[model samples]
Target: MVEEKEKREDLPPVNFSMFILSLNTSALVHLGELPDPHSQQKKKDLALARQTIDILDMLKEKTRGNLTREEEKLLDTILYELRMIYLRVSGGK
Candidate 1:
């Protein structure tokens, strides 16, 4: 029991970017079939999506015109999806 508890404690704390990356990875692995919309996991997904949008906004400001065409496209897609998720969570105005 002590060893199991220690192992659990040794795991890293999930952060915004890490959580987003995890969601992305899991979504890809599962072909985008995520948890129930009202589940706690969904809440984490929403939070991660918001954080991803904030990070991308900062990156856009910091690297404007410095990214390759493909990079720009990818960032645009990510930002758009994040915005959609944000609006859904915020009760679409």
Candidate 2:
């Protein structure tokens, strides 16, 4: 019944986790950690990556007390990993 409808592929799944995933992909791509799907080339752009991270940080800050435990964990984990990778790639910059 309702379960089948909920499982339909035509329905777009929208959620905070998906938002974080998109931002994470953008940050990774900018950091050259992920190959550019379009160009098939890995190009490091620390500045752009930093910008993406900052945006995530902003979301993290602004969404304080509003996100569920899972959302908070996902955001925190992503930020930590991305920051560490960014620092290493940018030579601790």
Candidate 3:
């Protein structure tokens, strides 16, 4: 476990921005916009994608007035892009 811990420690410090990006990556994977890390294949899981998007939305609502200007802009832009992609992928349903 020492080796694993050392590897993880080399990663960037976890912060709100990092957290948001992680969720963004997950949503992209679920939406088939990016390949799944484990499977190395792009697959559409609209339900999962929607859930991830909703989680980001909830974070935006909950963190209202708490995020820095840059952070807030990142969240808004990501949410909007994801929703648009979702609509197109889901046939606007």
Candidate 4:
């Protein structure tokens, strides 16, 4: 709908930071740190969480030295937080 499109247009512009944030959100949802948007229920899917985390890690490695300080810090913080949460949720496995 035109109204829906207009609402979406109000969203933040796509960028590296937004991309990373989106992945972070997905990881959180998989880790049960956040509810699944569609189901509105919390669920743990360790494998999927790990996969999403790995994707972020891969991006960090592939984009090293190219990201701005803020972006780098954001990625590092997100990765560290997610890893800690994952460990806690997975019994430190």
| Highest-scoring model, lDDT | 4
Please give the TM-score that candidate 3 achieves against the real structure. Answer: 0.95
lDDT of 4 at 81: 99
What's each prediction's TM-score?
Answer: 0.49, 0.86, 0.95, 0.96
Candidate 4, pairs of clashing residues: none
User: TM-score rank, highest first?
Assistant: 4, 3, 2, 1
- Residue-level lDDT of model 3, residues 28-80, one tens digit each, is 99999999999999999999999999999999999999999999999999999
What are the C-alpha RMSDs, in order, of all predicted structures? 7.6, 5.2, 0.8, 0.8
**Model 3 stretches astray by more than 4 angstroms:** none
Please give the TM-score that candidate 1 achieves against the real structure: 0.49
Off by over 4 Å in 4: none
Screening candidate 2 with a backbone cut-off below 3 angstroms (N, C-alpha, C), the clashing residue pairs are none
Q: How much RMSD separates candidate 4 from the native structure?
A: 0.8
State the weakest 10-residue window (summed lDDT) of model 2.
5-14
For model 2, the superposed segments whose C-alpha errors exceed 4 Å read 1-12
Report backbone clashes per prediction: 0, 0, 0, 0
Candidate 4 has a TM-score of: 0.96
